[model samples]
Target: MEQVPGGPERQSSTSGLPSCYRHPGVETGISCTRCERPICPQCMVSASVGFHCPECVRGGSGSGHSASASRPRTVAGGSVAADPRLITKILIGINLAVFIAVQVVGNRLLDDLALVGRWPPAPFPATQGVAEGEWYRLLTSVFLHQQFWHIGFNMLSLWWIGAPLEAALGRARYIALYLLSGLAGSALTYLVASPTQASLGASGAVFGLLGATAVLLRRLNYDMRPVIALLVINLIFTFTFSGIAWQAHIGGLVAGIAIAIAMIHAPRERRVLVQYGACALVLVATVGMVVARTAMLT
Candidate 1:
C-alpha cells in the first residue's frame, strides 16, 4: 500500500481504514483498472491505455487479464458445452472400435452383440436361428456397417456435418436429432425398401445432420441455396450410385428438416417439454408408418 505519484490517497473499498494505506489522504476515485481494487489517488497511475493500480502496473498483470477471463464457459444448464470435435472423435472411435471387434470376433457374435436384422432385412441378413425384430435393428444396425468404405464415408460425413450442426444446436438437441433421425431414416427405409434386403449405417443420421444444417443456416440468416444444391447433388448420387440406400437418406433428411423446423421456428425461449414432446410425436408417427408398411409387406 505505498503511494505511486498522482493525487490524494483514498481508503480501500473493502477496508474502511483511513487515508489510502497506499496513498494517504489523496482521494483517488479511480479503482484499480486491472483488478478493480481500490487505488489511492497517489498509488493510482495513468498508463497509455488506462489507469492502473501500482501493483498491477508494476506487476504487468494488465496485458494478461483479458486473456484469462475471456475463455468461454464450458457448462450450461447442467451440461457441458458440446465440442464438435469431441463428437466427431467419439463417433469415429465407436465406429472404428466396432469395426475392429467385428473383424476379430467374426459373425458368430452377431446375436450376442444384438446385430440381428429387424422386421425389414438390413444390409446384412440375420444368421440362421437369430430372431428378427424391427425394434432391435433400430438401435443395432447403427453400429453395423457393410463395408469399410460404408462406415468410412458415413463417419467422414458425420464429422463434417455433425460437428457444426451439433455445435449450433447444443449437445442434447443434437444428440436427440441424431438418434431420432436415424430411427426415422430407418423407418422410411423399411417402408420403402424390400423386406428381403437389409440396410445399415449412420448415413441416415448424417443425412439428418444435413437436414438440420439446412434448417439452421436458414435460421441464422445464412444463404441456404448452397445447402439446397448440395442436397440435390447428394440425392442424385444416391440414385445413381449402386448399393446406396436412398430411402434411409431421404427419411433422415425429412425427419431432420421437420425437427429443425420445430427447433428453429418455436419460441425464442424454447420450452424443453414442448420441443421434446414434438420430437416424440414425430418419432411415434414415423414408427407407426413403418409398422404399417411392414405389415402390408407381410
Candidate 2:
C-alpha cells in the first residue's frame, strides 16, 4: 500500500471521521478555517469565521509565513482587537447615557422613545406608534429604561454576556447582532402585544446576548449546565413577572440562536457570505413583521 501525502490515511480514521491532525486518535467535526485541518476542541482556536489549529494561528517563520499569524481573526472572521471588550463598553455607555437622558427629561423622552403599538390610549388621538411611522422606536426603545433596577440589571447582563461575545465575534458583528436582536424583539412585541401597552428596556438585547453566549459555549464544547440553568431561570421569570415584555425575550432569543448558529458553523469557503447573509435575512424578517403589525394597527 502506498502512503498518500496530506490524504485520508494521514488525517482520517477507520470510523469515517476525520482525526485531529495534532491528535491522531481524536476525531473532530471542526477544521481549521485557514488550513482545513481537522482539529479537536482542545486544538480549535477560535477564528473570525470558524476554528483554527495552533499551527495556522502561530504562522511560520521565514519564507513559510502566513497571513493569520500576522493578523489574527475572531470566530466570526473579524480582526482581533487589542481591547476585546471595547464594543461592550461602548454599548453600556450608550445605554447609560440614554437612561440618564430619560431621568433628566422625564416621561417626555420616554414617551417619545418607548415601543408603543399605539399611543394616547383609546380616548385620545392615536398619534404615536410604529403604526404612525415612528420606526426609530424599535431600536431606541431597546436602550430606554425608567427604573434604576432595570438599567442596573440590564447593564450588568450586557457586560457579563456581551464582553465575551464581542471578543468572539468582533466589534462590527457583535453590534450588528445586538441591534438586530433588539429590533427583532420590538417587532415581535408590536406584532402580538396590546396596541395600547408600551414597552421599553434593554432586556431584549441582553437576552439575545445570553442566547448567543449559550451557542458560542456549545460550539466550543464547553460545559453547558450553567448557561442552560440561567436561560431557564430567565424564561421562567419573563413569564411570571408582570409588566415584562415576554414577546421581546422570546423573539430576541430565537434570533440570537439563529444568528449565532450561522456565525459559528458557516463553512470557511463561504464564511462572509453565509454569516452576513443570515443576518440580512433576520433583519428582513424583523422588518416584515414590523410592517405587517403596523398595517394591522393602522
Candidate 3:
C-alpha cells in the first residue's frame, strides 16, 4: 500500500495539511495549545484556554507547567462533559449501591464496614462492626446506611453541595477532602461516642463538602451569610436529632475547613502538592487521634 509521506496511508475524511501528531493516519488542522502539535478531534482535550493533546495535557499537569491546570479533565466516567461533576455522581452511586445491598443482604454488609466506637463485643451491635484492629472502618463507614430516608437525605445534600464543589475544586481535591473528612469523623466518633455506639452514613463527607464550600466562598470574597446560616441550621438539627453522630458532623466540618484552607490558598505553582500535603496532614492527625483513643481504651 502506498502512503502519503507525512500523513495517513488512507485518505482521511478530515481536511487538513498536517496529520494528527499521534495519529498519522488522521488529518487534522487542530493543533495543541501547549505544544502546537496537530491533533485530530478525538486526540484533543478541551481546555479552559484551548485544545490540547493528551501528552501535552499530561506533561502540563506537573513540573511547574501552568497550562495543565485548565486542561479538560477526563475522569473515571465514560466521557467528561462540561460541568461533569463526576466525583460527586460516583460518591452518590456507591452510597446508593450499598444502601440497596443492605436491603438485599439484610444489613450484613454494614457489620464489616460501619464505625463502632468500641473495641469488643457489644450485644446487638452489627456483628462485624469496627473493633480493635479494624482501622479501615474510619473510612468505610461513610458509605454504609440502614434507612432509606437516611440515605435519601444524605444523597440529596451531597448532590446539592458536591456538584458545585466538585466543579470548583476539580475531582481529585474534592475526593480527598471528602474521604479525609469521613476519616476525621470516624476518629472523633471513636473518641467521643459511647463505646457501644455504631455509626454509619455519608453525613461526615457531606459536611465536609459544606465546610469546603464555605471556605471557598469566604476566600473568594463572596458573602458567607448563607453558608453560616446553613451550618447553624444543620448543627441545630444535629443536636435535636436522636441517634445522630454530631461528633462526626463537627469533625468532618473541621477537617473540611482545614483541607480547604490549603486548597484555596495554595499558590498556582505548587497547588497539587500543597493540596495533597494538607489532606495528608489531616489523615495523619486523624490516625494519631485514633491511636491515642485506642491507648486510652486499652
Which candidate's TM-score is highest? 2
TM-score of each: 0.65, 0.81, 0.71
Quote model 2's TM-score.
0.81
TM-score, structure 3 vs. true: 0.71
**Which residue pairs show collisions in model 3?**
111-128
Q: Indicate whether candidate 1 or candidate 2 has the larger TM-score.
A: 2
lDDT of 2 by residue, 140-239 (tens): 8998888888889889999988987887787888988899898899889989888877888888888888898899889776568889999999999898
> What lDDT tens digits, residue by residue, belong to model 3 across residues 1-298?
0000112232345443667666677555567777677765445565655566666666743334554544444311112345447788899999899888888997557666778756345454333334467888877788888887888999999998888667556667778889999889888888877656778888888888899889867754555788999999999999886778888998999999999889876765676788788988998999888888877755
lDDT of each: 0.61, 0.80, 0.72
lDDT at residue 78 of model 2 (Cα atoms): 74
Question: Cα miss at 111, model 1 (Å)?
Answer: 7.8
Candidate 1 lDDT, tens digit per residue, 1-298? Answer: 0000113334543434344435455333446556665553234344433445545644544445532221221111112242435655776688678777877886544434322223224455444211344466655566666467777888878887886565555567777888888878777766666554456677788888899888866754555788899889988888887777787788888888888777655653454655677689878977796668756744
Residue range with the least summed lDDT across 10 consecutive positions in model 2: 1-10
Which 10 successive residues of model 1 have the least lDDT summed? 69-78
What's the lDDT for candidate 2? 0.80
